[model samples]
Target: MYTIGQVAKFLGVSRDTLKFYEEKELVKPKQNIENGYRKYNRFDIYDITTVNFYREMDIEIKKIQELRKSKSIEGIKSLVDEKEQEVLKEIEYKKLILKKLQIVKEDCEKIKQFLGKYTVKEMKPLEIRGEIEHYTAYEEYETLKENTDSLKKAVTLTSLRRVIRFNDEGMLEDKFIIVRKVEDFEKDIEGEIVSHPKCMYTVIEDGRWSTGGKNTDHNVEASLRKAAIENGYKLLGLVYINLLLTTYEDGLERVFLEMYVPIK
Candidate 1:
Protein backbone atom coordinates (compact mmCIF):
# COMPACT_ATOMS: atom_id res chain seq x y z
CA MET A 1 0.00 0.00 0.00
CA TYR A 2 1.14 3.50 -0.82
CA THR A 3 0.02 6.89 0.40
CA ILE A 4 -1.70 9.29 -2.07
CA GLY A 5 1.37 11.53 -2.18
CA GLN A 6 3.73 8.57 -2.77
CA VAL A 7 1.55 7.22 -5.56
CA ALA A 8 1.34 10.65 -7.16
CA LYS A 9 5.16 10.99 -6.96
CA PHE A 10 5.66 7.51 -8.53
CA LEU A 11 3.27 8.32 -11.35
CA GLY A 12 4.75 11.80 -11.98
CA VAL A 13 1.31 13.38 -11.43
CA SER A 14 0.11 15.81 -8.81
CA ARG A 15 -1.93 14.65 -5.86
CA ASP A 16 -4.82 16.83 -7.09
CA THR A 17 -4.83 14.94 -10.40
CA LEU A 18 -5.13 11.65 -8.56
CA LYS A 19 -7.93 13.20 -6.49
CA PHE A 20 -9.65 14.30 -9.72
CA TYR A 21 -9.42 10.74 -11.06
CA GLU A 22 -10.97 9.53 -7.82
CA GLU A 23 -13.73 12.15 -8.07
CA LYS A 24 -14.46 11.02 -11.61
CA GLU A 25 -14.85 7.47 -10.29
CA LEU A 26 -11.94 6.32 -12.46
CA VAL A 27 -9.97 5.13 -9.40
CA LYS A 28 -10.96 4.19 -5.90
CA PRO A 29 -8.22 4.21 -3.25
CA LYS A 30 -8.58 2.55 0.08
CA GLN A 31 -9.30 4.86 3.00
CA ASN A 32 -7.57 4.65 6.38
CA ILE A 33 -10.46 5.40 8.73
CA GLU A 34 -8.17 6.01 11.68
CA ASN A 35 -6.15 8.81 9.95
CA GLY A 36 -8.64 9.74 7.23
CA TYR A 37 -5.94 9.30 4.58
CA ARG A 38 -6.18 7.70 1.15
CA LYS A 39 -4.19 4.52 0.45
CA TYR A 40 -3.46 3.06 -2.99
CA ASN A 41 -2.95 -0.67 -3.57
CA ARG A 42 -1.35 -2.40 -6.55
CA PHE A 43 -4.66 -2.47 -8.45
CA ASP A 44 -5.18 1.24 -7.79
CA ILE A 45 -1.67 1.95 -9.15
CA TYR A 46 -2.42 -0.06 -12.30
CA ASP A 47 -5.68 1.82 -12.86
CA ILE A 48 -3.99 5.18 -12.40
CA THR A 49 -1.26 4.16 -14.86
CA THR A 50 -3.89 3.18 -17.41
CA VAL A 51 -5.73 6.48 -17.04
CA ASN A 52 -2.49 8.44 -17.46
CA PHE A 53 -1.63 6.50 -20.58
CA TYR A 54 -5.00 7.17 -22.17
CA ARG A 55 -4.83 10.85 -21.24
CA GLU A 56 -1.47 11.05 -23.03
CA MET A 57 -3.19 9.58 -26.07
CA ASP A 58 -5.71 12.48 -25.95
CA ILE A 59 -8.62 10.20 -25.09
CA GLU A 60 -11.54 11.92 -23.42
CA ILE A 61 -11.92 11.40 -19.69
CA LYS A 62 -15.45 10.12 -20.18
CA LYS A 63 -14.25 7.66 -22.77
CA ILE A 64 -11.49 6.52 -20.44
CA GLN A 65 -14.06 6.01 -17.69
CA GLU A 66 -16.24 3.97 -20.05
CA LEU A 67 -13.11 2.07 -21.12
CA ARG A 68 -12.27 1.27 -17.51
CA LYS A 69 -15.80 0.10 -16.79
CA SER A 70 -15.96 -2.15 -19.83
CA LYS A 71 -12.28 -3.25 -20.05
CA SER A 72 -13.05 -4.15 -23.69
CA ILE A 73 -10.05 -4.42 -25.99
CA GLU A 74 -12.33 -4.32 -29.03
CA GLY A 75 -13.98 -1.13 -27.78
CA ILE A 76 -10.62 0.56 -27.28
CA LYS A 77 -9.49 -0.56 -30.71
CA SER A 78 -12.64 0.91 -32.29
CA LEU A 79 -12.06 4.24 -30.61
CA VAL A 80 -8.44 4.30 -31.77
CA ASP A 81 -9.54 3.45 -35.30
CA GLU A 82 -12.03 6.31 -35.34
CA LYS A 83 -9.35 8.69 -34.12
CA GLU A 84 -6.96 7.45 -36.78
CA GLN A 85 -9.52 8.12 -39.53
CA GLU A 86 -10.12 11.60 -38.21
CA VAL A 87 -6.37 12.28 -38.17
CA LEU A 88 -6.08 11.06 -41.76
CA LYS A 89 -8.88 13.36 -42.88
CA GLU A 90 -7.20 16.30 -41.19
CA ILE A 91 -3.92 15.51 -42.89
CA GLU A 92 -5.58 15.45 -46.32
CA TYR A 93 -7.38 18.74 -45.65
CA LYS A 94 -4.14 20.36 -44.57
CA LYS A 95 -2.38 19.13 -47.68
CA LEU A 96 -5.08 20.75 -49.84
CA ILE A 97 -4.70 23.98 -47.91
CA LEU A 98 -0.95 23.97 -48.49
CA LYS A 99 -1.46 23.36 -52.19
CA LYS A 100 -3.84 26.32 -52.43
CA LEU A 101 -1.37 28.52 -50.57
CA GLN A 102 1.38 27.63 -53.01
CA ILE A 103 -0.89 28.37 -55.97
CA VAL A 104 -1.83 31.79 -54.58
CA LYS A 105 1.81 32.60 -53.99
CA GLU A 106 2.64 31.77 -57.59
CA ASP A 107 -0.26 33.85 -58.91
CA CYS A 108 0.86 36.82 -56.88
CA GLU A 109 4.36 36.55 -58.32
CA LYS A 110 3.00 36.30 -61.90
CA ILE A 111 0.77 39.36 -61.42
CA LYS A 112 3.73 41.31 -60.04
CA GLN A 113 5.78 40.44 -63.12
CA PHE A 114 3.07 41.13 -65.74
CA LEU A 115 1.14 44.11 -64.42
CA GLY A 116 1.01 47.03 -66.91
CA LYS A 117 3.09 45.17 -69.52
CA TYR A 118 2.37 44.13 -73.06
CA THR A 119 3.99 40.91 -74.31
CA VAL A 120 3.56 38.15 -76.83
CA LYS A 121 4.07 34.52 -75.94
CA GLU A 122 3.40 31.11 -77.39
CA MET A 123 0.93 29.26 -75.19
CA LYS A 124 0.20 25.59 -75.17
CA PRO A 125 -3.30 24.45 -76.00
CA LEU A 126 -5.54 24.57 -72.91
CA GLU A 127 -8.74 22.72 -72.14
CA ILE A 128 -11.23 24.78 -70.15
CA ARG A 129 -14.06 23.10 -68.32
CA GLY A 130 -16.99 25.34 -67.39
CA GLU A 131 -20.18 27.08 -68.52
CA ILE A 132 -20.40 29.37 -71.59
CA GLU A 133 -22.64 31.94 -73.26
CA HIS A 134 -22.84 32.54 -77.02
CA TYR A 135 -23.57 35.79 -78.80
CA THR A 136 -23.85 36.50 -82.47
CA ALA A 137 -24.21 40.28 -82.73
CA TYR A 138 -22.94 43.19 -80.63
CA GLU A 139 -26.55 44.17 -79.79
CA GLU A 140 -26.70 41.33 -77.17
CA TYR A 141 -24.22 43.17 -74.90
CA GLU A 142 -27.01 44.29 -72.55
CA THR A 143 -28.34 40.75 -72.09
CA LEU A 144 -24.83 39.50 -71.66
CA LYS A 145 -24.15 42.17 -69.05
CA GLU A 146 -27.36 41.28 -67.20
CA ASN A 147 -26.34 37.61 -66.94
CA THR A 148 -22.74 38.33 -65.95
CA ASP A 149 -23.43 38.43 -62.22
CA SER A 150 -25.16 35.08 -62.06
CA LEU A 151 -22.61 33.56 -64.40
CA LYS A 152 -19.81 34.81 -62.18
CA LYS A 153 -21.53 33.45 -59.08
CA ALA A 154 -21.96 30.01 -60.60
CA VAL A 155 -18.40 29.73 -61.93
CA THR A 156 -16.83 30.93 -58.69
CA LEU A 157 -18.77 28.57 -56.48
CA THR A 158 -16.35 25.64 -56.93
CA SER A 159 -13.39 27.13 -58.83
CA LEU A 160 -11.63 30.39 -59.75
CA ARG A 161 -13.03 32.01 -62.89
CA ARG A 162 -11.03 32.62 -66.12
CA VAL A 163 -13.23 34.03 -68.87
CA ILE A 164 -11.97 32.89 -72.31
CA ARG A 165 -12.96 33.88 -75.80
CA PHE A 166 -14.01 31.29 -78.34
CA ASN A 167 -14.53 31.24 -82.11
CA ASP A 168 -17.15 28.78 -83.32
CA GLU A 169 -17.20 28.90 -87.13
CA GLY A 170 -16.52 32.67 -86.98
CA MET A 171 -19.19 33.23 -84.31
CA LEU A 172 -18.02 34.82 -81.06
CA GLU A 173 -18.66 33.18 -77.68
CA ASP A 174 -17.47 33.58 -74.09
CA LYS A 175 -16.55 30.63 -71.90
CA PHE A 176 -16.01 30.75 -68.16
CA ILE A 177 -13.23 28.32 -67.30
CA ILE A 178 -11.46 27.21 -64.18
CA VAL A 179 -8.35 29.30 -63.62
CA ARG A 180 -6.16 26.58 -62.25
CA LYS A 181 -3.97 24.42 -64.45
CA VAL A 182 -5.42 20.94 -64.32
CA GLU A 183 -3.28 18.08 -65.59
CA ASP A 184 -5.90 15.38 -65.38
CA PHE A 185 -7.61 14.72 -68.68
CA GLU A 186 -10.82 13.60 -67.07
CA LYS A 187 -12.57 15.89 -64.62
CA ASP A 188 -16.05 16.21 -63.14
CA ILE A 189 -17.18 19.68 -64.15
CA GLU A 190 -20.45 21.59 -64.32
CA GLY A 191 -20.21 22.84 -67.90
CA GLU A 192 -18.99 22.11 -71.40
CA ILE A 193 -15.26 21.83 -72.12
CA VAL A 194 -13.73 24.15 -74.69
CA SER A 195 -10.22 23.94 -76.09
CA HIS A 196 -7.99 26.96 -76.62
CA PRO A 197 -5.66 25.98 -79.47
CA LYS A 198 -1.92 26.31 -79.15
CA CYS A 199 -0.94 29.58 -80.77
CA MET A 200 0.94 32.87 -80.44
CA TYR A 201 -1.11 35.41 -78.53
CA THR A 202 -0.56 39.09 -77.74
CA VAL A 203 -1.31 40.03 -74.12
CA ILE A 204 -2.09 43.57 -72.99
CA GLU A 205 -2.68 44.78 -69.43
CA ASP A 206 -4.71 47.89 -68.64
CA GLY A 207 -6.84 49.31 -65.83
CA ARG A 208 -10.24 50.98 -65.58
CA TRP A 209 -9.73 54.75 -65.48
CA SER A 210 -10.09 56.72 -62.26
CA THR A 211 -13.25 58.37 -63.66
CA GLY A 212 -14.97 54.94 -63.83
CA GLY A 213 -15.94 55.76 -67.40
CA LYS A 214 -13.47 53.57 -69.35
CA ASN A 215 -14.30 50.43 -71.30
CA THR A 216 -10.99 48.75 -70.53
CA ASP A 217 -11.86 45.52 -72.31
CA HIS A 218 -12.78 47.23 -75.58
CA ASN A 219 -9.70 49.43 -75.41
CA VAL A 220 -7.38 46.51 -74.74
CA GLU A 221 -8.93 44.44 -77.50
CA ALA A 222 -8.54 47.27 -80.01
CA SER A 223 -4.91 47.71 -79.02
CA LEU A 224 -4.25 43.96 -79.45
CA ARG A 225 -6.01 43.99 -82.82
CA LYS A 226 -3.93 46.93 -84.01
CA ALA A 227 -0.68 45.32 -82.87
CA ALA A 228 -1.54 42.03 -84.56
CA ILE A 229 -2.51 43.73 -87.84
CA GLU A 230 0.59 45.93 -87.87
CA ASN A 231 2.77 42.87 -87.34
CA GLY A 232 1.12 41.10 -90.31
CA TYR A 233 -0.78 38.65 -88.15
CA LYS A 234 -4.48 38.01 -88.69
CA LEU A 235 -6.84 37.72 -85.67
CA LEU A 236 -7.80 34.05 -85.62
CA GLY A 237 -10.25 34.06 -82.73
CA LEU A 238 -12.29 36.17 -80.35
CA VAL A 239 -10.38 38.12 -77.68
CA TYR A 240 -9.83 36.69 -74.21
CA ILE A 241 -10.24 39.00 -71.21
CA ASN A 242 -9.21 38.11 -67.69
CA LEU A 243 -9.80 40.31 -64.63
CA LEU A 244 -6.51 40.43 -62.80
CA LEU A 245 -7.21 42.70 -59.85
CA THR A 246 -9.67 45.32 -58.65
CA THR A 247 -9.42 48.15 -56.13
CA TYR A 248 -11.61 51.00 -54.99
CA GLU A 249 -10.48 54.45 -53.86
CA ASP A 250 -12.10 57.84 -53.40
CA GLY A 251 -15.52 56.41 -54.26
CA LEU A 252 -14.28 55.19 -57.64
CA GLU A 253 -13.66 51.65 -58.91
CA ARG A 254 -10.42 50.60 -60.60
CA VAL A 255 -10.04 47.23 -62.29
CA PHE A 256 -6.98 45.65 -63.90
CA LEU A 257 -7.85 43.55 -66.93
CA GLU A 258 -5.63 41.37 -69.11
CA MET A 259 -6.57 40.87 -72.72
CA TYR A 260 -5.27 38.01 -74.90
CA VAL A 261 -5.77 37.72 -78.61
CA PRO A 262 -4.62 34.76 -80.70
CA ILE A 263 -2.66 35.76 -83.80
CA LYS A 264 -1.12 34.04 -86.82
Candidate 2:
Protein backbone atom coordinates (compact mmCIF):
# COMPACT_ATOMS: atom_id res chain seq x y z
CA MET A 1 0.00 0.00 0.00
CA TYR A 2 1.15 3.55 -0.68
CA THR A 3 -0.06 7.04 0.35
CA ILE A 4 -2.19 9.19 -2.04
CA GLY A 5 0.80 11.60 -2.33
CA GLN A 6 3.07 8.73 -3.46
CA VAL A 7 0.51 7.51 -6.08
CA ALA A 8 -0.04 11.06 -7.34
CA LYS A 9 3.72 11.68 -7.76
CA PHE A 10 4.23 8.28 -9.46
CA LEU A 11 1.25 8.81 -11.82
CA GLY A 12 2.10 12.50 -12.55
CA VAL A 13 -1.31 13.82 -11.45
CA SER A 14 -2.57 16.36 -8.96
CA ARG A 15 -3.85 15.54 -5.45
CA ASP A 16 -7.23 17.10 -6.32
CA THR A 17 -7.45 14.83 -9.37
CA LEU A 18 -6.92 11.73 -7.21
CA LYS A 19 -9.53 13.08 -4.78
CA PHE A 20 -11.93 13.62 -7.67
CA TYR A 21 -11.42 10.01 -8.81
CA GLU A 22 -12.10 8.88 -5.24
CA GLU A 23 -15.25 11.04 -5.10
CA LYS A 24 -16.44 9.54 -8.43
CA GLU A 25 -15.97 6.09 -6.78
CA LEU A 26 -13.56 5.21 -9.58
CA VAL A 27 -11.10 4.16 -6.89
CA LYS A 28 -11.62 3.43 -3.17
CA PRO A 29 -8.46 4.21 -1.21
CA LYS A 30 -8.03 2.92 2.31
CA GLN A 31 -8.25 5.67 4.94
CA ASN A 32 -6.16 5.80 8.10
CA ILE A 33 -8.58 6.09 11.05
CA GLU A 34 -6.06 7.85 13.33
CA ASN A 35 -4.62 10.54 11.02
CA GLY A 36 -7.44 10.52 8.40
CA TYR A 37 -4.91 10.03 5.58
CA ARG A 38 -5.84 8.36 2.26
CA LYS A 39 -3.84 5.15 1.50
CA TYR A 40 -3.74 3.85 -2.10
CA ASN A 41 -2.96 0.22 -2.88
CA ARG A 42 -1.45 -1.17 -6.10
CA PHE A 43 -5.00 -2.09 -7.22
CA ASP A 44 -6.05 1.56 -6.75
CA ILE A 45 -3.01 2.63 -8.83
CA TYR A 46 -4.07 0.27 -11.64
CA ASP A 47 -7.62 1.71 -11.60
CA ILE A 48 -6.21 5.25 -11.75
CA THR A 49 -4.06 4.29 -14.73
CA THR A 50 -7.08 2.83 -16.51
CA VAL A 51 -9.14 5.99 -15.80
CA ASN A 52 -6.30 8.19 -17.10
CA PHE A 53 -6.10 6.16 -20.30
CA TYR A 54 -9.84 6.62 -20.96
CA ARG A 55 -9.59 10.36 -20.24
CA GLU A 56 -6.68 10.78 -22.69
CA MET A 57 -9.01 9.34 -25.31
CA ASP A 58 -11.49 12.17 -24.44
CA ILE A 59 -14.00 9.79 -22.85
CA GLU A 60 -16.35 11.75 -20.58
CA ILE A 61 -16.33 10.97 -16.85
CA LYS A 62 -19.84 9.45 -17.01
CA LYS A 63 -18.87 7.33 -20.00
CA ILE A 64 -15.66 6.26 -18.27
CA GLN A 65 -17.70 5.22 -15.25
CA GLU A 66 -20.02 3.17 -17.47
CA LEU A 67 -16.95 1.71 -19.21
CA ARG A 68 -15.48 0.70 -15.84
CA LYS A 69 -18.67 -1.32 -15.16
CA SER A 70 -18.91 -2.60 -18.76
CA LYS A 71 -18.05 -6.32 -18.96
CA SER A 72 -19.01 -7.06 -22.59
CA ILE A 73 -16.28 -6.92 -25.25
CA GLU A 74 -18.85 -5.85 -27.90
CA GLY A 75 -19.87 -2.86 -25.72
CA ILE A 76 -16.25 -1.70 -25.55
CA LYS A 77 -15.90 -2.08 -29.32
CA SER A 78 -19.05 -0.04 -29.95
CA LEU A 79 -17.69 2.81 -27.77
CA VAL A 80 -14.39 2.80 -29.64
CA ASP A 81 -16.27 2.93 -32.96
CA GLU A 82 -18.28 5.98 -31.82
CA LYS A 83 -15.06 7.76 -30.79
CA GLU A 84 -13.49 6.99 -34.17
CA GLN A 85 -16.40 8.61 -36.06
CA GLU A 86 -16.22 11.70 -33.84
CA VAL A 87 -12.46 12.07 -34.57
CA LEU A 88 -13.09 11.76 -38.32
CA LYS A 89 -15.73 14.51 -38.29
CA GLU A 90 -13.40 16.76 -36.30
CA ILE A 91 -10.63 16.21 -38.85
CA GLU A 92 -12.88 17.26 -41.78
CA TYR A 93 -13.97 20.42 -39.93
CA LYS A 94 -10.33 21.32 -39.31
CA LYS A 95 -9.56 20.81 -43.00
CA LEU A 96 -12.27 23.31 -43.99
CA ILE A 97 -10.80 25.83 -41.53
CA LEU A 98 -7.33 25.33 -43.01
CA LYS A 99 -8.63 26.01 -46.53
CA LYS A 100 -10.32 29.24 -45.39
CA LEU A 101 -7.09 30.35 -43.70
CA GLN A 102 -5.16 29.86 -46.92
CA ILE A 103 -7.74 31.94 -48.84
CA VAL A 104 -7.38 34.79 -46.31
CA LYS A 105 -3.59 34.73 -46.74
CA GLU A 106 -4.04 35.00 -50.52
CA ASP A 107 -6.47 37.91 -50.10
CA CYS A 108 -3.86 39.75 -48.02
CA GLU A 109 -1.35 39.24 -50.83
CA LYS A 110 -3.90 40.59 -53.35
CA ILE A 111 -4.32 43.76 -51.29
CA LYS A 112 -0.56 44.28 -51.22
CA GLN A 113 -0.15 43.75 -54.98
CA PHE A 114 -3.29 45.29 -56.49
CA LEU A 115 -4.41 48.05 -54.14
CA GLY A 116 -5.30 51.23 -56.10
CA LYS A 117 -4.19 49.69 -59.43
CA TYR A 118 -6.35 49.94 -62.58
CA THR A 119 -6.43 47.46 -65.47
CA VAL A 120 -8.85 45.55 -67.72
CA LYS A 121 -9.13 41.79 -67.18
CA GLU A 122 -11.58 38.96 -67.81
CA MET A 123 -13.70 38.30 -64.72
CA LYS A 124 -14.78 34.70 -64.16
CA PRO A 125 -18.46 33.90 -64.44
CA LEU A 126 -20.03 33.06 -61.05
CA GLU A 127 -23.23 31.30 -59.99
CA ILE A 128 -23.98 32.73 -56.56
CA ARG A 129 -26.79 32.72 -53.95
CA GLY A 130 -27.48 34.53 -50.64
CA GLU A 131 -28.36 38.07 -49.45
CA ILE A 132 -26.71 39.70 -46.42
CA GLU A 133 -27.75 43.31 -46.04
CA HIS A 134 -29.89 45.53 -43.82
CA TYR A 135 -32.82 45.60 -46.28
CA THR A 136 -32.64 41.91 -47.26
CA ALA A 137 -36.07 40.39 -47.78
CA TYR A 138 -37.38 37.66 -45.48
CA GLU A 139 -37.43 35.08 -48.28
CA GLU A 140 -33.80 35.76 -49.15
CA TYR A 141 -32.79 35.56 -45.46
CA GLU A 142 -34.48 32.18 -45.06
CA THR A 143 -32.84 30.87 -48.21
CA LEU A 144 -29.39 32.07 -47.14
CA LYS A 145 -29.78 30.38 -43.74
CA GLU A 146 -31.04 27.15 -45.34
CA ASN A 147 -28.07 26.97 -47.72
CA THR A 148 -25.13 27.20 -45.30
CA ASP A 149 -24.50 25.85 -41.77
CA SER A 150 -20.88 26.76 -41.03
CA LEU A 151 -19.16 30.13 -40.41
CA LYS A 152 -16.46 29.29 -42.93
CA LYS A 153 -19.08 28.75 -45.63
CA ALA A 154 -21.01 31.89 -44.66
CA VAL A 155 -17.94 34.19 -44.78
CA THR A 156 -16.68 32.56 -47.97
CA LEU A 157 -19.76 34.04 -49.64
CA THR A 158 -18.73 36.70 -52.19
CA SER A 159 -19.63 40.30 -51.26
CA LEU A 160 -20.45 42.78 -54.02
CA ARG A 161 -21.60 46.32 -54.75
CA ARG A 162 -24.15 46.54 -57.60
CA VAL A 163 -23.86 49.95 -59.26
CA ILE A 164 -26.86 51.13 -61.28
CA ARG A 165 -26.09 53.88 -63.80
CA PHE A 166 -28.01 57.15 -64.01
CA ASN A 167 -26.50 58.48 -67.26
CA ASP A 168 -29.06 61.33 -67.62
CA GLU A 169 -28.38 62.89 -64.24
CA GLY A 170 -24.64 62.15 -64.43
CA MET A 171 -24.91 60.12 -61.18
CA LEU A 172 -24.29 56.57 -59.99
CA GLU A 173 -26.10 54.52 -57.35
CA ASP A 174 -24.85 51.38 -55.60
CA LYS A 175 -26.02 48.77 -53.10
CA PHE A 176 -24.13 46.05 -51.22
CA ILE A 177 -24.99 42.35 -51.50
CA ILE A 178 -23.45 39.17 -50.05
CA VAL A 179 -23.96 35.86 -51.81
CA ARG A 180 -22.68 32.28 -51.65
CA LYS A 181 -20.89 30.60 -54.53
CA VAL A 182 -23.17 27.93 -55.92
CA GLU A 183 -21.33 24.76 -56.85
CA ASP A 184 -21.92 23.27 -60.31
CA PHE A 185 -23.77 20.27 -58.84
CA GLU A 186 -26.39 22.43 -57.10
CA LYS A 187 -29.60 22.44 -59.15
CA ASP A 188 -32.12 23.53 -56.52
CA ILE A 189 -31.17 27.23 -56.45
CA GLU A 190 -34.49 29.13 -56.57
CA GLY A 191 -33.57 32.33 -58.47
CA GLU A 192 -31.72 33.62 -61.54
CA ILE A 193 -27.92 33.33 -61.41
CA VAL A 194 -25.97 36.49 -62.39
CA SER A 195 -22.67 36.42 -64.30
CA HIS A 196 -19.91 38.87 -65.39
CA PRO A 197 -17.41 38.65 -68.22
CA LYS A 198 -14.69 41.07 -69.52
CA CYS A 199 -14.34 44.08 -67.24
CA MET A 200 -12.33 47.24 -66.43
CA TYR A 201 -10.71 45.97 -63.19
CA THR A 202 -9.23 47.99 -60.34
CA VAL A 203 -8.81 47.65 -56.56
CA ILE A 204 -9.60 50.59 -54.28
CA GLU A 205 -9.42 51.31 -50.53
CA ASP A 206 -12.68 52.46 -48.97
CA GLY A 207 -14.94 52.25 -45.92
CA ARG A 208 -16.91 49.18 -44.80
CA TRP A 209 -19.35 48.03 -47.48
CA SER A 210 -20.44 50.96 -49.71
CA THR A 211 -20.92 53.56 -47.00
CA GLY A 212 -18.62 56.45 -45.92
CA GLY A 213 -16.77 59.00 -48.07
CA LYS A 214 -14.60 56.72 -50.20
CA ASN A 215 -17.51 55.66 -52.44
CA THR A 216 -18.30 59.32 -53.12
CA ASP A 217 -14.65 60.28 -53.89
CA HIS A 218 -13.86 57.11 -55.88
CA ASN A 219 -17.02 57.27 -58.06
CA VAL A 220 -17.46 53.95 -59.94
CA GLU A 221 -19.14 55.13 -63.16
CA ALA A 222 -17.07 58.31 -63.45
CA SER A 223 -13.84 56.41 -62.80
CA LEU A 224 -14.74 53.78 -65.43
CA ARG A 225 -15.72 56.51 -67.95
CA LYS A 226 -12.36 58.26 -67.38
CA ALA A 227 -10.46 54.96 -67.64
CA ALA A 228 -12.36 54.02 -70.82
CA ILE A 229 -11.55 57.33 -72.54
CA GLU A 230 -7.90 57.14 -71.40
CA ASN A 231 -7.51 53.55 -72.66
CA GLY A 232 -9.72 54.16 -75.76
CA TYR A 233 -12.19 51.41 -74.79
CA LYS A 234 -15.99 51.68 -74.75
CA LEU A 235 -17.83 50.69 -71.49
CA LEU A 236 -20.82 48.36 -71.61
CA GLY A 237 -23.37 47.36 -68.92
CA LEU A 238 -23.77 47.90 -65.13
CA VAL A 239 -20.77 47.92 -62.76
CA TYR A 240 -19.96 45.19 -60.17
CA ILE A 241 -17.66 45.93 -57.23
CA ASN A 242 -16.43 42.87 -55.33
CA LEU A 243 -15.17 43.28 -51.78
CA LEU A 244 -11.69 41.72 -51.33
CA LEU A 245 -10.41 42.59 -47.83
CA THR A 246 -11.28 44.73 -44.80
CA THR A 247 -8.94 45.96 -42.09
CA TYR A 248 -8.37 48.91 -39.76
CA GLU A 249 -5.85 51.74 -39.95
CA ASP A 250 -5.26 54.35 -37.21
CA GLY A 251 -8.59 53.50 -35.51
CA LEU A 252 -10.59 53.75 -38.76
CA GLU A 253 -12.05 50.82 -40.70
CA ARG A 254 -10.82 50.40 -44.30
CA VAL A 255 -12.13 48.13 -47.05
CA PHE A 256 -10.45 47.00 -50.30
CA LEU A 257 -12.91 46.61 -53.17
CA GLU A 258 -12.25 45.01 -56.57
CA MET A 259 -14.24 46.89 -59.25
CA TYR A 260 -15.47 45.16 -62.45
CA VAL A 261 -17.00 47.43 -65.06
CA PRO A 262 -17.82 45.34 -68.15
CA ILE A 263 -16.30 46.63 -71.39
CA LYS A 264 -16.92 45.82 -75.05
Candidate number of the best TM-score: 2
Error of 2 at 46 (Å): 1.8
lDDT values, one for every candidate: 0.62, 0.71
Per residue, candidate 2 scores C-alpha lDDT tens digits across 135-170 of 344445555555554554452334434445545356
Query: What's the true lDDT of residue 26 in model 1?
Result: 92
RMSD of 2: 3.8
* RMSD each, Å: 8.1, 3.8
Report the alpha-carbon TM-score of model 2 versus the true structure.
0.79
Query: What overall lDDT, based on C-alpha atoms, would model 1 receive against the true structure?
Result: 0.62
lDDT of each residue in 1-264, candidate 1, tens digit only: 999989988789999999999999999998978998998999999999999998887788988988987857788899888778877877877786687578556656656776655566544334443333433334534433433323323323223334545443433554554333434564644344434443334333333345357545455556555666677766776555555555566656665544556666
Q: What is the lDDT of residue 217 in candidate 2?
A: 45
What lDDT, from 0 to 1, does candidate 2 have? 0.71
